[model samples]
Target: MSRALRAPMPDLFLGLISGTSADGIDAAIVRFEDGAGRLRADLRLGRTYPWPEDLRTQLVALGQQAAPLTLDDLGELDSRIAEGFAQAANRVLAEAGLTAADIAAIGSHGQTLRHRPQGRHGDGRHGFTLQLGDPSRIAERTGIRTVADFRRRDVAAGGHGAPLLPALHAALLHAPGEDRAVLNLGGIANLTLLPADGAAVRGFDTGPANGLMDAWCLRHTGQPFDRGGALASSGRIDPTLLARLRAAPWFALPPPKSSGRDQFHLDWVETALTGHEAPADVQATLLALSATTIADALRATQPSTVRLIACGGGVHNPALMAAVADALPGIAVVSSAAHGLDPDHVEAMGFAWLARQTVLGLPGNLPSVTGAAGPRVLGGIYPA
Candidate 1:
């Protein structure tokens, strides 16, 4: 860790993302400063702009592989998502009293529609991931330079191209003498391991975080998500159902792995159901599956990790957080807020950091984490 010093005039970057949940577009205006081998990110403002219901519905359906999509459908969805992202960027800029001129670049993670890092044959070759929200469209609409399509480069380099936030996690939250792990509990949960001895940082997806739970909650309760995880908290965890979920072959796979709604959607959960359990109990079991998988991955990979800093929307769920805490007996589990990072916007902020890296021609993906051939600059830049 570099000594904290007064930062000079910082660069402002806007980050936009809509995770697998497709709930909304998270827009973060982040101010970054680099000095003394230290990089700092201070959130100027962060907001989640709701997606138009029809578009969001289409996104959810397509993401879950529940809806068929033609090439025209793909093109239309891509343009619509880019328009949505541009709208969100403009709205956040207005709210922050800034304009495109004030921002160095907009980093759009886009909406991931499919992620198959191991390919359809379970082999490492021919893997690809898709994130829709065109950088060209974003730049054209916002009049700001944009960096998008950050994942495919790593996939092309024989990497998972998921869990790309570990580089940013290490920069912002890594402590010198503390073996800490950063867990991003988005639609999927991913863990970034930062060792005290400065070993290579490693991270990988641990499976469903909020994606399955949110989908299940919406299907059964008509609510988009389990508010405060109240529905889950009111139910009992079905041990049998949890065992079936935990038996997934993906969980047994080693590091350099990733998954998304395409792999762990409502259908996946439904297949594991015994047909005798209540909807609430199923919800409870899904929550348990997330907690246990996260804990199991951590224990298997980095047993010495004493602190777990969690971020993403799942951090707001008291039930999920408590469940994770219960699963990890000795680990100090806490939200990223404990370390001065907003739990909701950590990922959005990470894209901001990634954009800065791309603008500076620096490598963004950690080869150890992604299993890339070597350090490679990720993403393409679109001029305003």
Candidate 2:
């Protein structure tokens, strides 16, 4: 059928995703036809539905340092997440004046559990990543073919299997005449640097973003998230603590790398401030650690004149954004909205775009960025 309608392009493809933050599920309906090493897309519609309070609380707790999660708990949580995702897709389709039948295929990233790259060697070859929305359920419920479980294959092929959206970032935001950077400040912060020519894309997870900040806020203020980074801004940055956080080995690692709560959790934050620091001070330092680390990653790429397009939940954090701008003086910082993409929907849209790639038999993962063996096709498809 694709071959029949394959007049160099198709009408639309939809992508669904739930990120490390586990805040909620997002769905993006897009229409794209192949362009030169990229795609021409119309972001038809997008929406976010909050995860059930109980489930969100559970997932957050699991990622936190105070209370650890067990294997059984993780399994059950994954199922609950799958259901939430199906509902999100349904909501998106309805909002877009469409149905499952209107979409080419749904691309879902599932919920990530643990994301360790393969072959840890002496640390043990236990490097593996897990994302849990069941594609079978998604396909069955949405009545559309679904493609999901997008990461592990890269890890198995000796790569990080994350920051998978660089392909989309390059396709959509790479400026023709100037270098640009797409910074996603979700639960974790990651950046995709697009060279002026839009040829090469480089990206990696830059430690923590709202994940640690939110965890800290929950412990101290009983709030799920620090609204607008107000709590953090009200505090003073602890230089000594910031230095310790910057010293974390993850910060020194090279690109084609990724990390999650396993690496940057409340415990890691606490360890940085072990010797008695005020809670607000800790919050401030955590925010600095995130901003400084992301800036450092951008600087390492050494691209000339980077116009940073900030997205995800962190874009709304004025304090965090201020820190980011301050850290990189020469670089201009702006929101993804400037490029006609909503900050909150960028990652979700990336997954939707990836789903299109899968059905079109295109390689979604970037070999240069994720370090996959080559441009291998990503995701496993499950039919309704």
Candidate 3:
């Protein structure tokens, strides 16, 4: 049970997270070994466990509900969500033929119930980003040290505390003398720019990615997501709707801004749907919205080369991918898989690396990408 007898920290680490969509939990068991004086990480195995439909609905509502939830209600939801995270961690361990003792630590990004990344955030601030998965519960249940609350530490240090995977993006994917952009189209879309000349990295959310499209799909089709962009492919894009949706201030805002369900919810979509448009057409327009915003963000980054590699659930959507490719003429759009990484598991793998960083007293946040005042070690440890 002591550190002296346990497996070496570099042997393995586990990462668990559920994105803004509240759709499911992504779990990855990663192998890290010393490679030429640097720790090398390879994702050994990963899987996604969807949130129960009912609980998913509750968390979605609680995320941006104007109606306040009681303290007891909030507490109960937090515990339940942590229990779900624990379940996913246990499942990943079993699938990978590993035990808690085999892992040095488990990094959990948790479920973001509300992420207020700006405006007086920290321990005493009224508004602060909150991720709800009790690390204590995770450590207790998994019998492994858990590193979580990775965001607030950065936020407290005057950072956006989001899109943290860019550190791993630079680590795993960055190539010398090659300008590349990594885009993650989760519930929200964010862009990370890696310059060929080793310039400071820049990244920010590009507005609604799958979040709006998924919401619209759920409302119209009763499915959680529009599988493979079929709905969009079947429908026509409404230009007027597209213009209205893009008019939001977030698009024009410079780098370092982040958004969540609060900025791109169904109510916002309803407001955008002023005229009578076919539901499917709106879906098509939403897809276009994601593509256009992502394209625009990459354009703003304006790397020496327009080589863009995309990751996340959105990468699975053919229509969206096509739209993005079409938006950026002459640029080759590729999946992260081409670079030896599964799109769905990149974020989870990043957190596993982050956990290792925390355990070893290394800095995990990128000040250039996060807009943090400076680089600082992130996350608090919850030991088993």
Candidate 2 to truth, TM: 0.93
Let me know the TM-score candidate 1 reaches against the reference structure: 0.96
- Cα deviation of 299, candidate 2, in Å: 1.1
What lDDT tens digits, residue by residue, belong to model 1 across residues 90-127? 99999999988889999999999998877878777688
What is the per-residue lDDT of model 2 for residues 28-84, given as tens digits with 9 covering 90 to 100?
888776767766767899888899898887777666634676888766776788788
Q: Order the candidates by TM-score, highest first — what do you get?
A: 1, 3, 2
| lDDT ranking from best candidate downward | 1, 3, 2
Relative to the unseen true structure, what is the C-alpha lDDT of residue 199 in candidate 3, on a scale of 0 to 100?
Answer: 80
Off by over 4 Å in 2: 1-10, 35-38, 65-74, 118-124, 197-199
Best by lDDT: 1
| lDDT scores in order | 0.92, 0.82, 0.85
In order, how many clashes per candidate?
0, 1, 0
Model 1 residue runs over 4 Å out of place are 1-10
Worst 10 residues of 2 by lDDT: 118-127
Best-performing candidate as measured by TM-score: 1
Native-referenced Cα lDDT, model 2: 0.82
Model 1 deviation from the true structure expressed as Cα RMSD, one decimal place: 4.1
